[model samples]
Target: MLSHTRKNKILEILKRHKQISTQELEKQLSVSGATIRNDLTQLEEKGLIKRIHGGAVLPERESKNSFRSFHKRSEKNVEEKKAIGKVAKNYIENGQTIILDASSTVLYLLPYLTQYEKLTVITNGIYTALELKNEEDFNVILLGGIVRPKSGSVEGLIGSCMLNDISANLMITSAHGFNVKNGLTDFNFYEVELKKKMVEKSDRLIAVLDHTKIGHTSAAQFASSSEIDLLITDSQINDKDLKEIKDSGIEIIIGK
Candidate 1:
């Protein structure tokens, strides 16, 4: 009945069965539904499993470098990201089709979207899609692709073919880092590839970032400075970097 022992049992089940539903977990462990969900989240965070709809699956590991936890990354700079989300929502209007990437920071924007109606959302984020699934006022589209457990996103660009049929008014995204020269860069190569299609399909782009990302560059460039219409970040950003981004012809908002 101990938590660790229960989790070990769940892993053993995953090893034997490959995947199991929440109901099965509850029955097998003789625990409440809430406990099973909590254990799954913990296991997913540790890069041990991938949380899918109503169940969990084992992570596919190519190497040690494959285990990047998007949820844990989202937990950092909580107040800052919330502020950025607030600023980002101001540009969004009702009754418009929008694209959203699966970055942890973009997840913060979800809470502020209930005010809008008749909004069509296209996204490759499994967690993001699940959050919006029950909203009666919004039409949610989850793209088809390879799902990455650590990133909690659907990548590999297979879902990008859907973008050719639909165009969005705007797209909201986050990057691992950004610099005046390299623009918005991301550490995930698969995510970067999908975001490129998202950029081409949307009329405008809004970047949601924390101050730490400013003036830094990552593995790949997804958006150049000229391609972004607006950059929203926490107030902790210094003046020089702020002015440089603003000078690049991209509007900027400092969330307080």
Candidate 2:
């Protein structure tokens, strides 16, 4: 396997076992002891693991703000995000006004949006607005604010004020992490504020979360489970946590 793919496999194994020996990794991965050692060293340098005499262990705990940039995240779960975006499109109707958040997952909606004959899309995602620029049937409004270069998302007071002035029939958003307790949480404070405003100005709020985000908590809580009108996620979500979220009364739509 490629080095990055091997490292990701190691991470998956570590997540399940908490720790794994170099000898075991070599046996499992069909690689040499030296290769396992090298992977462990790299993972340790990334603060994802702690090296021991013969193995590596997961870090004591991950930081709440341990979020990847938009580019990085966009590559992580492409298939799941595409499935989610396709399902999310079903909620939109022609001639309706909608708010789309500045999330990599939300970007997948661009292709499916062609079904709409006429739509008004308001967004803070720089790339999202640009993606719709060529669609003559859509009226796209790009919100104004401080642009977060890492995520290409517009935020801060200016964007929040702009969101407050407009109301949408529906709002589609994604979060850094989510759980029953924290609901929809994110790493960026400014993005969190803007998302809260989007929630306030929309008639219905739909959180499009991939399975990876389920049961995870981030630095800032934007909306509680009770506050969300719907949640669209992939079918790989854990049954236990899914039950808890369903029990909380939030409607769930599982994407294939």
Overall local distance difference test of candidate 2? 0.84
Per-prediction tally of clashes: 0, 0
Off by over 4 Å in 2: 1-67
lDDT of 1 by residue, 207-255 (tens): 9989988987755678998898889999899999988988787889899
User: What clash pairs does model 2 have?
Assistant: none
RMSD of candidate 2 to true structure, Å: 11.6
After superposition, the stretches of candidate 1 with alpha carbons farther than 4 Å from their true spots are 1-67
Weakest lDDT window of 10 consecutive positions for candidate 2: 60-69
**Per-residue lDDT of 132-241 in model 2, one digit per residue for the tens?**
99999899999998886767889878888877678899999999889988889875556777888889899999999999989877656789888888899998899998
Using Cα atoms with residue i matched to residue i, what is each candidate's TM-score against the true structure? 0.73, 0.74
Given candidate 1, what's the lDDT at residue 175? 86
